[model samples]
Target: MSKETLTIEVSWPASLAVPEGSTIDIQLWAGNDKAGYSMIDGDFSTPATASPVTLEIPYDSQDLQSHDGTTTWDHFHTSPRLVHGGFIKNIAYAEKISVAQTKGAAWKMALR
Candidate 1:
């Protein structure tokens, strides 16, 4: 069993008002047919320039093995009210991800 790191990049609209050094909480969920589910939460700081922020999350071998080759993941911001929400469909393990909020207050999720 080998462990793998899942990297998720979250972005904010330039027009959005995000104060610098604000705490952003990310809630992530990954699940497969056999593994049932796994959840991880992390916090990151908003860069002064609103550049894309990245988060690295680690999953153990057991979790990876239980994935059954394909997995589905969803993530969203849990604080600061900056981002609305987002989700991803069937994907092979984890890859570079980018999440952002639309101007109309809707959230979007994508794999980068």
Candidate 2:
């Protein structure tokens, strides 16, 4: 499989509540499931806006798969081939957000 650098820019809604100088963990999941192939995580000055992270990803036919009658795919495998057809798609997720503790302030998170 041919290899290339994949750059992804991640950001959050401006209306969302985010603490300044908090650490954010971003994960890149490929294919049809939650098994992530690559990840980039660090502490940034602003949690709402993050710099683009790059992943050395496989491309071309070896980067793709087809679910014919007998073809099988497993998430635990380390192969970069995640797409099930002729196209490539991926999912980006933000996780493990660390909030800075403030003196005399109460922290509350609303779940949707």
Task: Give the winner by TM-score.
Answer: 1
Query: Each model's C-alpha lDDT?
Result: 0.39, 0.28
RMSD of each: 10.9, 16.7
Colliding residue pairs in candidate 2: none
Give the number of the best model, judged by lDDT.
1
lDDT per residue, candidate 2, 1-112, as tens digits?
4333332224333444444443333232223244434222222211322333222322332332333423222221121211223332222322222112211232222111
Off by over 4 Å in 2: 32-112
| TM-score of candidate 1 on Cα atoms, chains taken together | 0.46
lDDT of 2: 0.28
- Model 2: lowest-lDDT 10 consecutive positions: 73-82
Q: Specify the poorest-scoring 10-residue window by lDDT in model 1.
A: 95-104
